[model samples]
Target chain A: MKENYDIVIIGGGPAGLAAAVSAYDNGAKNILILEREPRLGGILNQCIHNGFGLTRFKESLSGPEYAYRFIKEVEARDIDVLLNTTVLSLEDNKTITAINSEYGVFSITPKAVILSMGCRERSRGALNIPGSRPAGIYSAGTAQKYVNIKGYLPGKRVVILGSGDIGLIMARRMTLEGAKVLAVCEIMPYSSGLRRNIEQCLNDFNIPLYLNHTITKIEGTSRVTGVVVSKVDENKQPIEGTEMHFDCDTVLFSVGLIPENELTKGAGIEQSRNTRGAVVYQNRETMIDGIFACGNVLQVHDLVDFVSEESEIAGACAANYVLNGRQEHNPISCINGDNISYVLPQKIDKNIPGNVKLFFRVRNTFKHCKIVVESNGVVLQEKKKLICVPGEMETVILSSDVIAKAEGDIVVRLEC
Target chain B: MNKQLTCIECPMGCLIEVEVENGAVKSVKGNTCLRGKMYAENEVICPLRVVTSTVKTVSGKMVSVKTDKPVRKSEIFEVMKKINSLTLDRNVVIGDVILANIDRDANLVATQNYND
Candidate 1:
């Protein structure tokens, strides 16, 4: 390990690997990737399902296969990778404090740092589900790890809650593993999972999906025995006399994902109120001079392809900041208008002189919608879509000419 | 008879309606792309899907594997049975064929590496 390096990426997942490769390609020869796992492919190792890399590779690939493509590149370029190393903190001066079993506590002051610690699933405790603390409850991702990586069956009968992508995928995965999947319950009318997953994972398997319903109570003393599900009203409160019961041994929670940004917050970096990650510019550089962030650590992405694209921006910009001091650029704030939940690259540097892709998601489901980007009532760009859902992400590219025409904050809105 | 299906060829999940006469696809409508049209026709005739799963290794670890191509959707369970019954005799690397000619020339290959 060197005392000083050009760039240090905190995670070894798809984002970290891609960022390191991009940094190296951009002339940052001395770069290091810190991965807490024993291997390079982070969450992808356990994500054994296909449907990854559709946009980036132009082919549908399994999670591990998509990650291996980048892992091979990183190995070919002779990039430095430190596995089984956990970064404890990031200081304000770009110093990283990390530790591993092989090496004791140590700190490295890098010229630039990239934060790629991905997000974590929201557990049952976070959901506030009233239930006895049983042994059969596991997060969808945790169950995925056990079944796909450890070769262990977590349970025999499963009932998934919250209809997220991971939960929907696990519904099919658990079913294929010879487990009886009774039902999948969602509190909202619409599912947060992608349309393909809902159709393929759940619909194909004949597993009943109950929308506008939630788990009212978990009835298990030692292990999971059953759960009481009830339909919820418009306000999300369970309606009386609308309860249904299922006999299942396990309950899987797929409520949502929370970005792992404690280190970013502890370092006193500016955080986005919506993304809960570091507020970054179009180049993915955070408010801190050389600290950049991308991937799930920046914003939870629906596809790994988008993660790779965002990390490349972070990696390239981090390299530029290290080689040439932060270049002079004027900042233009990008705001989320009506129906828009959140917009990435919260601020764009107009002087960057190129096209910048801004990714965002809608707050709800809409049909026949026009996504428009405008500034000071002047439309910059518009795209028509047949349908837009909160589960899938949408991107809009802003050319330099359109950006230059902005006299005030740029607004991205959905015009119905 | 007519059937409605969502075209999963790409992210644009277009709702396609297929006209069937005596179990044969007569026409595929409402699809925006050529791939979607093909998907609707095949779905009505015989659907196929890529199956991914993990097999037990000799070292007591699991190695993820997937079909080289889509297999008959109706035979997914049968193919999974073939996959679940096998225990690797030796360690294999990614892209190594675990089972060949599985359900219509689809090879089951390793997607993950397990080092003992």
Candidate 2:
């Protein structure tokens, strides 16, 4: 391994692979991708379901197939990659400390670094469901890895806890594999998963989706035997006298995903309270110069197609930072307005050229609403939508002319 | 016959109402796009879906595979049975056909490269 390089991307998932390829294509020849997995594809290896790459490729592809497109691109570009290598630390000075079986403790000082470590599913402990430490309990993603990668079924009868995409997909998967799916309970009234998944994965299989319900208590010892499902009130507190019982062996938790930002935090980078990831600019560069983040590490994207698009921006910007040096940044804060959960590229550099795409999600479901972007009481952009749900992310573009005329912090909100 | 279906063509998940008369789709409503209209029509007449799953290699490793095209939804389990029973010992790359004519003209192809 080289002691110095132009760009070092952490994680070889779809994000990292696409970043590396984009960096190489944009003039940075010396680039390296460090993947902790034995292979290049990260989470995509275990995501065997189709419905990926719809926007980018304009064709529905499986996770591995979507990843293969970028992997093939990386191979064709002859980009360097180190599999089974875990990055130990990332310093503010753009230095990376990594370790692998081939090489012991080593360090590399790259001119620019791109973080694409992705996100992890919120496990049972995170959910704090009153349950026994049973053997049949597994996170939805873990169950996916078990069934899709290891070729082992987690259990025969399953009761998924949350209606996240992974849980919804597993509902169908376990059923197809000859397991009996009892129920999918979600505490929230609306599922965080896409509507398409709710239609295809759960509705198609005739799986019961109990909204406003949660597993109140888990009854099991060495293995899962059953769970008590309870209905929740508007405040999400379990109500009395509304208990349902299900006899199932496995309980899969698919609550939510948290961005893996250990290294980002270690680097002392500013973090976003909403995304739980690094606070980046329009170009995806973090507070620290030359250190950038994209993909799930930046924001948990609903589609891999957006992950690829965002990582490409990070990759290209990192290359520019390496070749042309740092450009002037006139900071413009983007405030989350009413009903807006969070907006990405938390801050934008006004000096950057071209239009800017601001991605965000609503706090709740709204019908026949208008998304408006405002700065200093002047409307920059506004668009009408038939419906807006927290499950689906929304984006609005701001032209350079409107950005140039901005006088104060920009705000994005719903104008119902 | 009147049927209600959700358009899976995109994330919008348009709740479509289809009017079928004598086993033919007469009308589709509530779809936001052309694709949703087509999807509703096809779903009413004959539904199709791309099946993706993992097949075991000789080395006991799992290699992901998918149908090259959408197959009849009714024959998904039959296609999966064919996929589950097949075992390959040869090296294969993405787009390589693992099983041909598994569902009509839809070939089961490898989604991930496996070398053993």
Candidate 3:
């Protein structure tokens, strides 16, 4: 391992692999990718289901296949990858401390650093569901790894909690593997997962989806035996006299994902409350100079195609920072308006060349609405949409001319 | 017969209603794009799905594989049975055919490279 490099990307998942390839292609030859896993592909190795790379490859590919495409690109470029290495700390001075069996307690000072560490599943401890800590409970992704990677079934009868995409997919997977999936309960009225998953994974298998419901109590000892699901009111509080019991041996939690930002926090970098990640500019450069973040570490993207695209921006910009140095520009804040959950690239460089794409999500479902991008009471762009749901993300582009004409902060909102 | 279906072609998930008469799609409505319309028509007439699963290798490691093309939805379990019972004894790369003609016209190919 080299003591110095041009760029060091943490986390060798789809984001890290794409970033390394892009950085190499953009003339940053000396780059290294640090991966904690034994292999290059991160979570993609266990994601055996298809429906990936639709936008990027224009073909429905399984997770491993999608990852292999980028992995091959990185290999062709001869990028350096450190497997089974975990980064311990990231300092603001572009210094990374990592450890592995090959290199014990080493530090590398790269000219630029890119953080591609993805998100993690919300665990049972985070949910605080009143239940006994049983052996049959597992996160949806853990169950996926168990069945797809280890070739072991988690349980015979399963009741999945929270209708996230992983849970919905596992509903079909367990059923196909000959296990009986009892029910999928979601406390929210609307499922956070993609509508396509609900169709293919749950609807096709005739799995029951209980919306506005949550597990009120878990009844089990050494192993899971049953669960009491209760309906929630408009405020998401469980109501009385609406408990439904299901006899099952396992319970899978797929509530939500939180960006793994412990290293980001340790670096004292500015964080965004909306994305739970680092605050970055249009080029994905973070508040700290020469440091960048992309993929799930910047924002939890719905599709891997978008993750690759965003990581490319981060990679190219990191290369630019290494080669040409940081350019001087005024920063413009992008804020979420009414009904807008969050907008990314929280800050945009006013003097940036070309257009900037702002990705965002809606707070709730809206029909026949107009998405308006405005600055200082002047409408920059407006588009009509048939429907907008929180499940799917939305993107809008802002031309350089409109950005130059901005008088104050840019705001994105949904107007009915 | 009028049937309701959700277009899985994209993330939009437009709800499409299809009218079928005499085993043919009479009309498709509520799709926002051409792909959605085609999906609705094909779904109402004959539903098809691409099956993906993992097969055991000679070393007892799991290697991901998938159908090369969409097959009859009703034959998914049959295709899975064929995939489950087979194990690869030789090393394989992506796109290598693990089971030829697993279905009528679809081939089960390795989605990931496995060396055993």
**Best prediction by DockQ:** 3
Candidate 3 lDDT for residue A93 = 91
Which lDDT values do the candidates have, in the order given?
Answer: 0.91, 0.92, 0.92
Ranking by lDDT: 3, 2, 1
Q: What would the per-residue lDDT of candidate 1 be over residues A1-416, giving only the tens digit for each residue?
A: 76678899999999999999999999899999999999998999999999898788888788999999999999989578899999999988998999998788899999999999999998888778887898899999999999998999999999999999899999999999999999999999998987778888998899999999999999988999999999999999999999999999999999999999989988999999988889989999998889999999999999888899889989999999999987876898899999999998999988787998989999999999999999999999999998888988999998888888899999999989
Residue B41, candidate 1: C-alpha displacement in angstroms: 1.9
Ranking by DockQ: 3, 2, 1
Error of 3 at A71 (Å): 0.5
Query: Which parts of model 1 are misplaced by more than 4 Å?
Result: none
Give the worst 10-residue stretch by lDDT in candidate 1 chain A: A123-132
TM-scores of all candidate predictions against the true structure: 0.97, 0.98, 0.98
Instruction: Please say which candidate is ahead in DockQ: 1 or 2.
Output: 2
Model 1 reproduces a share of the real contacts of 0.60
Cand. 1 Cα-lDDT: 0.91
Error of 2 at A144 (Å): 0.6
lDDT value, residue A373 of candidate 1? 97
Residue A7's lDDT in candidate 3: 96
Show the colliding residue pairs in model 1.
none
lDDT of 2 by residue, A258-317 (tens): 999999999999999999999999999999999999999999999889999999999999
